[model samples]
Target: KKEKVDFIVLLTQSEPELNIEILEKYPEINAVLAEEKSEKYNFVTYVGEKPIVSPQGNMGSIVKIDIFKNKDGKIKQSLEFLPVDSSVPSDKEMLKLEEFYKEKLDRDLGTVIAKNNVKLDSGFGENHHARYEESNIGNLIADAYKNHFNTEIAFMNGGGIRANIESGDFRLRDAISILPFSNKVGAFKYSGKTIVEALEHGVSSVDKKAGRFLQVAGMEYSYNPKDEVGSRVSNVTVNNKPIELETIYTVALPLYIKNGGDGFQMLKNTVGTVEIDSEKNIDSDIFIDYVKKIKVLNPKLEGRIVVK
Candidate 1:
């Protein structure tokens, strides 16, 4: 019965063109079903006259293909999309899923962690501004690493902060949502010159919303956005003392940045690189612990990053 079918559908997340070529080897396969590269809904394209049906991820929609045989013995195909409405009432299976998720993820982890609201000033949660200037939430997150690792200076990439939290009860879910990545905390001994170079790279692409912006703790610096990229940062200091070019300062940051993620190549070449508290410590867990310890969390921008 399978051999008698007129259409062959291949479901995959790989490149569409490669899948089409593989399907062509089988002459019996007239039409191939595959997902769109862009994951756009209701998208249909032809690869060498073969109909390819692509569906969006997360079951965003159901793709329906209708094939018709013309009177002249030719075949024609059309597509339809059935979007998934999450607001619809749950079925029996969905109710079971709700129960499963609640048992696993919906437990009270802790009481209110902050007395005041923690602001997330990422240019209204936009990318470009977060990496360029000081943000309350950014400062808080960077402080977490600094405190946990007991480093002289710590900073995190602006892109690592995923969301903002209002003044209210803090939960494990909140921390998870904010620091979604599983980046481990890392520390290294770096010179003031290297620190300056890293900060220079951080602000190099501020106009493009690049993710390399450094949100720091235990140190502060002033920079002119209008200045040339490598020469923007100045007045850098660690512990209120001006950064000495010959001094090797201990810095704490995510392993992602330490390994040159987000263009932090200078960090990877630090004097003595070390992973703090083992690589098992996750970013979200550290942030959660910091909030729990501080209780009344209030992080403010105090010219840690002076942007003129």
Candidate 2:
């Protein structure tokens, strides 16, 4: 008697070379599922010696596989991938989903989070042009972090601010849309010298409108974009006092930055990092709370970052 074998499915987004090695190592593996590289909602399939890159259809996919024994007593396999559309749900399912959202997500909590005097600049789905300027939205977000954690300073990356806020009526969705990453708030102890280096790195790609541009609170500094990279930042101050190179200052920032996201290498290299549990200190939630407490938000371009 012979044993029956089952087909194997592998799901990954690794490099093509790595996928090829996996396919070579496992002959029984029939299909490899992954997100579409083309950024389209449609599903695409590539068959043959190379590893398969299956598209994750806009809503989802239903993959069906058939295995059977051939006349030669060898197993053969066939794959059927069905991409589901957003409207494929039954009427009953739609009703249930609507009810769930109404009970949980859609209800207005009757809370006014913050008031914006002017439309805050943001580049959520656009070119990310806010990374090159001292934006009112960025200032408000950094200030919220500083106030929430009561830290000496707070640093935020412009890339993290996903959407702009219009004047008046800031709701829960508005706040969530502006900071959708849900990164946890964290604190780190670093010397002023490292802080300056981090600032230099933040502005190094200003001409390219890179995401590494910084938005800060509880501290201010000046930089000349025309100056050479790594030497642009100067006149850093914390709490109305000039920063000392050897003095270690506590800083509040997102956990992503502490892990060196957006080229914040100095934050990652810091010896001790204290992360507030996400349940207790989600960035979006904290900022919402800060706004609710303050009632009115009037952040302005106060020369915190001077491009001389």
Candidate 3:
């Protein structure tokens, strides 16, 4: 014993394979809490003998586990997940704050920034989220990054897109809600070899619909899903030209990737990185500014990413 502890729970931001590896190595871990979304497991799921629980997406579900000691002193766990809808009462204080936010946005002078003529979706569906694939919303954000920074290429990971805006007015609040993170958009002078490494790493876990799946601007790339992870990416063209392995290209990205977030360790060795101030270059701010500058939005899929 672990000081009167009968069970162990692991909270992780890792993928399913890593989580499974952890459980395999540490038998004491009885439960795993992750951000992975699944349509079937709106409740609970079993991996081997342990149960994996998730909050799903859109903040609409929660898991409840009941632990009990049997007459023989063996521990047992029962898992159940419930949907969190309007039926559940909200905390008055929290509800008040939410209402205040809504009212403030509604009355704000800069609330409406632009008008979107067509729906821009990131492939995050209600029953199934195909967020890893290239999407029009992803391309739009990627375009914003590339254009704002004046770089040869830019990338917007699909997972970063949180919500889809139906065709209509694009508001400041809508930009914030769609790309909610405070991560700053920045750029680096990276060798073509490093770019290849980053792309390989990005699609390494595509089967899991990982957040690393990159949606790109100024580039068209293809991959073989049946190939091994390190060799999957190929036929990459930047700005209508084949990538030159010796060329140093200026690439724009969210600081999360440049700083080695989401397993992009290859970037740690990059040079001439021009990072913008976080407060001035936050993703939501960039998005709002870009939409306002464009004044109109027309998002579409242009075959930037092909899966063979």
- Candidate with maximal lDDT: 3
Please give the range of 10 consecutive residues that has the lowest summed lDDT in model 3: 123-132
User: How high is each candidate's TM-score?
Assistant: 0.69, 0.67, 0.86
Q: Write the per-residue lDDT of candidate 2 for residues 17-50, one digit (tens) a residue.
A: 4566777777667667664433233343544632
Ranking according to TM-score, highest score first: 3, 1, 2
Q: Each prediction's Cα lDDT score? A: 0.76, 0.75, 0.81
lDDT of 1 by residue, 111-212 (tens): 445565665455534433666788888888889888888889998898777667676666667677778878788778999889989999988877755568
Model 2 local distance difference test score: 0.75
- RMSD for each of the candidates: 8.1, 6.7, 3.0
Span of 10 residues, lowest total lDDT, candidate 1: 119-128
Q: After aligning candidate 1 to the native by TM-score, how far in Å is the CA of 178 from where it should be?
A: 1.2
Stretches of candidate 1 exceeding 4 Å from the true structure: 1-95, 109-111, 118-128, 274-280
lDDT of candidate 3 over 85-140, digit per residue (tens): 88899999999999998788678834789999988887564511334467888888
Please state the error at residue 57 of candidate 1 in Å. 12
Pairs of residues at least 3 apart in sequence or in different chains that clash in candidate 3: none
Query: Model 1, 233: alpha-carbon shift in Å?
Result: 1.3
